[model samples]
Target: VFCMKGDYSFERIVSSDVDCINLKDPVPLLYLKDHPGLSYNDSSYSYGESLSEFLRKKDVGNYSCYINANSPLIIRKCPYDPYKHHGDDNGKVMKNCRDNGYYHESRDGACYLCRLEGKCGCEHYGFETFINPQKTNETGRVSACGSDHVIFSDDIYSGVEVIYNSENGLNEILYLDPHGHKVKYGMSGF
Candidate 1:
């Protein structure tokens, strides 16, 4: 959401879903000749006028226009170095996987770190403590780190499911031992 609290005003040009006050239409054909003081991010495709010229075209005084797409926007506030994953330094691994078109399967249901990598092997990795809320049993994959792990992983695999089991939820098989204790395998414990 963008906000301006000065001697300026703005209007949304388009919308995709709900008419949320902040949502703007996608790639709207805006007539800069009518709305003066309008500037857009058209670096690749040059708009015939200079920034000052475009602003002068609109009668609005000292206005700032923002173009926001309906796509999800994530704001991260941690001192994160995106180069590391687990103890394996899998930055290059992930990039190579993505570049070479290696796709991970989606596993349905909320998963703890051990369950995610061991039981499902969905290529996505995540972690959740007992204190966190149970994630939906939807098929998808994700990897996460730190305090914001759950939310980040959820967004990464939004609305994707691999299995369609109505009787038992996804990630249901718990690897238990004879003593009724959950067993950890394959470096699954954090």
Candidate 2:
């Protein structure tokens, strides 16, 4: 839903919603080999390295879901949907991001409030991912998502750079507009 007209077309930004690869593209890496929780390893290996070099330079530069708010394009389509919506029960988030189960298959939740599929606007940075279930995962309350269209204006997200790392907890996302041009995003829960 965010394409400020630069001659468009990653098949028209995945057909109608500029939710990065949801504005689909050539995504077949065939399981990207042994899923380090969909490849941003920490507990295991993937020494090849990529928790967020902007998803390995946007798959070696083929670009999809291009959001240039200053320079922004960082996403976590489903970091396990807030870890299975933790303690779900109509507080909200009932799970169903297409359920491929693990590695790669969830897609619905966490546009924060840009409102996926039904498509809302303000163009993202709507940040929402907060899991505190009593703080056990080492002082929780960081589910991770962010939206600040320069403090919510309605378009052209401005100035956002997140790098949570008390030892790798978000690890980077930079989206800014207002003529500075940027779009970087990375994620991890592996």
Cα TM-score of candidate 1? 0.15
TM-score against truth, every candidate: 0.15, 0.19
Worst 10 residues of 2 by lDDT: 128-137
Q: Model 2 lDDT vs. the true structure?
A: 0.26
User: Candidate 1's residue-wise lDDT over 74-183, tens digit each?
Assistant: 11111222222311332233223222322111232123333423332234442221101122353333211111121123222111111111234523111112211111
Largest lDDT belongs to which candidate?
2
Model 1 lDDT vs. the true structure? 0.23
Q: Per-residue lDDT for 74 in model 1?
A: 17
Name the runs in model 2 displaced over 4 angstroms: 1-49, 53-88, 91-93, 98-136, 139-190
Provide the clashing-pair count of each candidate structure.
10, 24
